[model samples]
Target: MKKNGNREEFNREKLLKGIVRSAEKRPVSMDAITNLVDRVENKLRSLGENEVSSQQIGEYVMEDLVNLDEIAYIRFASVYRQFKDMSVFYKELKEIMEKDKKKNQDQDHSGDK
Candidate 1:
């Protein structure tokens, strides 16, 4: 477990760095993202919730090929939460949209006055 944890942490870091590199038009490598995701999933299972770090998740999502601007964290949560069906996925998605809507509304109101 410790070995896997170390590997996962490393992969997570690499993925984040890879994203930054790729955003700069540098080469993006799949090996890095695959290793990162594999390690993260394993860690999430083996380590459980409290053990899984936000940095790790952020790094995994920031992978070079991930296209961060085109993807939302909710998308990751869908797969990570392992939704049993479309309904469950949509429910989670609705919540996210609502939150974003509220945030935008607040910003608009604030800007008006």
Candidate 2:
């Protein structure tokens, strides 16, 4: 068990190192980087809110910081929201999934019905 924990930590460290190298090679612009970080932060922070700002979302995407996109965002948001019960957590998950599916479905259609 301890060995597995060590392995996981090592893997995380290696992944972080790779991200740092990539960051160093082509430094992300401050404006873009700030936006992405903000998205990741806000997406993880806010809950019970109906809308997220477009500029903030764009900033997060431009920075390439939200690598996990919806999953990571959802995980982070769940913890941040402090879910009172499994039901609440699952409800949030379903809402997010439904929203994503609806978005994809809309994209498939050329025009509004």
Candidate 3:
């Protein structure tokens, strides 16, 4: 895996540890995490490349977490993004809230049809 222009061996255990840590105190299940890891591996394999970037893997993890559990997503994002201040955290929360609100609105509109 290439992280910040440095090539290194892909470490699945390290990836799992980060995921597990983020899910601590959250309701995300171990099975869910396993499935997510499997999916990420499949994606990487499908790309037909031996080298992948940490950012790419991080994006995949974030995508999975966002769909699986909001709290877990935030937890993972905080560490992945290295949030520096409350403002950054607040902004991330706001983006999630807005997206949720929009989704709810779309559902409401659909129900009216």
**lDDT per prediction?**
0.53, 0.49, 0.89
Off by over 4 Å in 1: 1-10, 13-70
After TM-score superposition, the amount by which residue 76's alpha carbon in candidate 2 deviates from its true location, in angstroms, is 1.0
What lDDT tens digits, residue by residue, belong to model 1 across residues 1-113?
Answer: 13244423334555445444433443434565466466656756775554555555654554422343223344445444567999997886687678668878999899787
Off by over 4 Å in 2: 1-34, 38-68, 111-113
RMSD of 1: 9.1
Provide the lowest-lDDT 10-residue window in model 3: 1-10
lDDT digits (tens) for residues 23-98 of candidate 2: 4434444454445555555553564444444344334442354343555445444544567999998987797788
Question: What 10-residue stretch in candidate 1 is worst by lDDT?
Answer: 63-72
TM-score of 3: 0.88
Winner on lDDT between 2 and 3 is 3
Q: Each model's TM-score, in the order given?
A: 0.43, 0.42, 0.88
lDDT of 2: 0.49
Clashes of each: 0, 3, 0
